[model samples]
Structure formats: structure tokens, C-alpha cells
Target: MSDLGNTFMRRFVQFINTADEKLGEELIAPNAEFYVPFQSEPLVGPRGWLKAVEVMRGGFPDVQWTLEELVVEGEKIAARYTMRGTHEGTFFGVPATGKKIAIQTMNFYAMANGKIVGERGQPDLLGLMQQIGAVPAPS
Candidate 1:
């Protein structure tokens, strides 16, 4: 992998763990597309991605992501990870419960010209909330 690719990967990881949205646009390409079926809203471009992330943080403060797997081939990277957080703040209408939560996620990113152009992720949002007692599981 090129140096730019490595840097991009590292920065992406940092952004995720820290929830530093300002660091996003610098690493993501303009017009980047983002998708996560479980997310209630659409996120497109760096700014939109940041906004969505903020919403998550607002709902689940202290959210953190750990990179368990990172594989890169050419211009594409796939990452499998888990997220940790505490529901100490209002999240999805749930009152601050100060409950800790963890969830698994898998994401793929396509790099173009050394910047992320596309990203798709599968996040177990509802399952996480249920695990943390923030929601009731279906029968």
C-alpha cells in the first residue's frame, strides 16, 4: 500500500475513535457517499458524515470504535470493528441511563486518489441498544 493509503487508514481510525469530525473532511473526498442501513438518516459527504456521528455521540456519549480487522487491497479497504459507548446522554429518545453499550460493525471504504470516496457500513444499532437496556427486545 502507498504511504498515502496508510496515512488515510490511520487517520480514519483516529477519527472514528475520537469522533473528531473536523478531521473527516480532510481525509474524505469531496462528494463522498456514506451508508449504514441502521442509521435513521442519510449521510453523504464529509460534513454529513460528521453530523451523523455527532448525533450518535449525542445519543450515546463517549462512544468509541475499535478496529479489529483492517484489510486493504489496491484502492479498497474493509474493516471489521466493534463500538463501545455509554448511554449517559439522551439517545434516540431514551433518557440518560448512564448505561454502557457495545456493538459490532463492519465497514468498507473505497479510496480514490488517496481519499475516501465511498463508505458502507453495517451497524447493529438496535441490538446494541437492547443489550444496554435502552430498548425492549421484540418477542
Candidate 2:
């Protein structure tokens, strides 16, 4: 992968795991859009991206996002990652369970002008919920 791809990957993961809104503004395009599973509507621009991070941080204050693999194809980047944290606050109406959760996530980021223009993510929501006791484990 090119340096641009690797660099953006680090910055993007840092922005999400740390709730760095400032970094979001720098790395994401002004009109960028993100299709994320957790939200009903698509996230627009850096501010909208930050909002999603805020919601996540509110529930997992110490969340850590680690990139396990990355592949770059022209202006698109595909990444496989993992997030680990303890549920310490309410999340989408679910109360804290003080459970440690590890969820796998995959993402495809589209870049333009050295900024992220769009992103689509798929995360292991079922596993995450089960870890936090929101969803029951299989029998």
C-alpha cells in the first residue's frame, strides 16, 4: 500500500477511537458522507462523523480501535479492524453492563484530494451486543 493509504488509515482509526473531532475535520472532506450501520441516516461531513464518534465514546469511554489489515485500490481503501472496550455508559438506550467487548469491523474508504470523501463500514453488531448483554448468545 502507498503511504497515503497507510497514513490515512492510522489517522482515521485514531480519530474514531479517540474522538478527535479536530482530526476528523482535517482528514475528512467538507462534503464527505458515511454509511454506518449504527445510525439511521448517513453521516455527512466531518461534524457528522464526529457526532457518531461522540455517541460511541459516550458508551465506550476507553474504546480502542486497531487496524489488523489494510488494502488499497486506487482511491479506495479497505481495512479490517477490531475494537475493544468496556461498557461504561448508556448506548442507544441500553444501560451500561460493565462488560468488556471486542468487535470486528471492516471498512471501505473512498478518498479524494487527500481527504476521505466517503466511507462504508460493516461491524459485528451481533457479537458486540452479545458481549454487552444486549443480545443473548447462541445456544
Candidate 3:
């Protein structure tokens, strides 16, 4: 992993945890594409990406993501992470339950000119729902 890639990864994690859309705007390219497994269409550009973050934060005001592992190679980075939050607002049609949830996630990113140009994330939605009592756990 090049130093630049490593630095980007670290900065990305910090920016996400901070929930600062302004700072996030600077880290992404104008035409960046962000993909989430459950979304029908990829989010376009920094504005679109920030909107998604805002929605997530609206539901989990104190949400935090912990980067467990990151590997970068030739401008492509892969990360494994866990997101923790308290269910304080509506999310995906599920109302607040005042429960704390932690879900695992994996993401891949493409970078160029020190900005993120592409991203794809797979998150544990079922696990998250179960933790928040939106879905029942198996007996």
C-alpha cells in the first residue's frame, strides 16, 4: 500500500466518524459513484453521497464506524468495518427503539488524484434490523 493510499484510508475513516459533510465533500470526486448493496441506483457525486450520510445520521445521530482492516493496492482500497449506533430515529421504515446496534460492513473504494472516485459497500442489514428489534432473532 502506498503512503498516499494509507493516508486516504485513515482520513476517510476519520471523516466518516466525524459526520462532517463539508469535509467529506472535499474527499470525493465531483463525479464519484457510490454503491450500496440494497440501493437500486448508485449515488452520484459528493452531494449525493453526503445526502445518504445525512439520512443515516438522522436515524443514528451518534453513529460511529470502526475500521477493522484496510488494504490498498494501486488506487483500490478494501476495508472491513463495524458500525455502532443507537436507534434514535426512524430508519428504513423502522421506528426508533432506543436500542444500540452494531453491524459489520465491507467496502471497496477506487481513488484518483487524492479523491475517492468510486465506492461499493455491503452492510449487514439483517443483523442490524435484528439488533434493533425491527426483525426477530432466530430461536
What is the TM-score of candidate 3? 0.91
Off by over 4 Å in 1: 2-7, 38-42, 136-139
Minimal lDDT window, size 10, model 1:
1-10
lDDT per residue as tens, model 3, 1-139: 5677767777888878886677787798989999976578999887777777777788898988888888888889999999999999999998998999899999999988888999999989899989989889999
| Number of the predicted model whose lDDT against the real structure is largest | 2
Q: State the lDDT of candidate 1 residue by residue for 28-134, as single tens digits.
A: 87798888674665577888677767877887768878777788899899888788888877777778887788888888989888788988888887887797676
* Model 2 global lDDT (CA atoms, 0 to 1): 0.88
Q: lDDT for model 3, please.
A: 0.85
The local lDDT score (0 to 100) that residue 77 gets in candidate 2 is 92
Residue-level lDDT for 55 in candidate 1? 78
RMSD for each of the candidates: 2.6, 1.3, 1.5
lDDT of 1 at 134: 67
Candidate lDDT values, in order: 0.79, 0.88, 0.85
The total of clashing pairs for model 2 equals 0
Q: Which segments of candidate 2 are over 4 A away from where they belong?
A: none
- Compose the digit string of candidate 2's lDDT tens values, residues 18-116: 777789888999899999887778899998888777777889898888999999999989999998988999986789999998999998889998899
